[model samples]
Target chain A: DQQVKQNSPSLSVQEGRISILNCDYTNSMFDYFLWYKKYPAEGPTFLISISSIKDKNEDGRFTVFLNKSAKHLSLHIVPSQPGDSAVYFCAAGKGGSNYKLTFGKGTLLTVNP
Target chain B: GAGVSQSPSNKVTEKGKDVELRCDPISGHTALYWYRQSLGQGLEFLIYFQGNSAPDKSGLPSDRFSAERTGGSVSTLTIQRTQQEDSAVYLCASSSRAGLNTEAFFGQGTRLTVV
Candidate 1:
């Protein structure tokens, strides 16, 4: 069973617009959620994260909103730029345990000019 | 000073043969983890090593797989009698410590092809 799932295989957005990516999970144990951006042949880079205690976390143009009751989360990038295009993976951890992360299949976001 | 590094970026071996993949975590990072990525199973945790704590091997798939970390700096993942199903990109990551919410830095990863 896939504990985490990213239903959208890919997404396209216009530059300077807001790009939103969605993810869902079946595991309720997960408390800390994070977003990682990856390029071809490169490992995923940590972008932003949100603790279960808070509904939202923002850094620069990236913001992550989490809805625990819905077991869903979304990543928003305002004024998206071409450089923001990459495969985004949503990962979650239970923390306090082993800090092991479970990642989604990833959504490839393309920002067009 | 440098980020995590993995050797033999790409390895192709015949079935029934054994292959070894190595990883060097960042200097002073007390936590290391190994994972496998495949189409069948998005990404699965293989193992983890944290300062003297008994390594977590629960994620290991079978007895044919094993891994070890030496001097708390380098780690090697060995596959005995490889099978076609074992073909996938193996990733290694490390963090300052296995703290509650510290992020991990990953290596480029070693792509293993079992032919």
Candidate 2:
């Protein structure tokens, strides 16, 4: 069973535009969510995360919004740049002892210059 | 290394042969994990080790797959009698602690191809 799902396989956006990536989870027990960005032949790099208690978390140009009731989360990059083109994976995990994360299939975002 | 390191970046093995993949976690990190990623598929959890606690092998797919962490530093994942379906990128990650709040750093991954 896919606990986390990223329905969109790929997305394209023009440079300087906002890029939004969405993710949904079936497991309500997950209290923490994370986003990772990966390039070809490279491991994923941690982008940002949010706690279920909060609705949003922002760092620089990247922002993550979480809706506990909807079991959905999204990553928004304002004024997207070409360097932002990569595959992004959304992951969910519980806060306590269980550190294992359930990840979505991933969404490939291409920022066109 | 400053980050997690996995060796044998690419390995091609014949079916029925056994393969061993290695991982070196960041120094002083006590938590380690293994995951598999198939083409167009999401990362699949394999196993986890935290300090002296019993390793969590619940995510292992089959009995043929096993892993060991010696001295709580380096880890080895062994696959016996590999099958074509076993071909995938094996990724290793390590964190300062075992918790959702800590970020896990991942290695470049070892790509295995069973022919």
Best by DockQ: 2
Regions more than 4 Å wrong, model 2: A95-98, B100-103
lDDT of 2 by residue, A53-101 (tens): 8999999999999999999999999989999999999988875434678
lDDT of each: 0.87, 0.91
TM accuracy, model 1:
0.95
lDDT of 1 by residue, A1-113 (tens): 78999999999999999999999999999988888887878866778888889999988898999999999999999989999989998888885353577889899999999
TM-score of each candidate structure, all chains considered together: 0.95, 0.95
**For candidate 1, lDDT tens digit of each residue in B1-115?**
4888998899999999999999999999999999888754456788989988899998889999999999988999999999999999898988896732346888889999999
Give the 10-residue window scoring lowest on summed lDDT in candidate 2 chain B. Answer: B97-106
What is candidate 2's local distance difference test score?
A: 0.91
lDDT (10s digit) by residue, model 2, range B1-115: 8889999999999999999999999999999999889988888889999999999998899999999999999999999999999999999988897753446788999999999
Q: Which lDDT value does model 1 have at A64?
A: 95
Worst 10 residues of 1 chain B by lDDT: B97-106
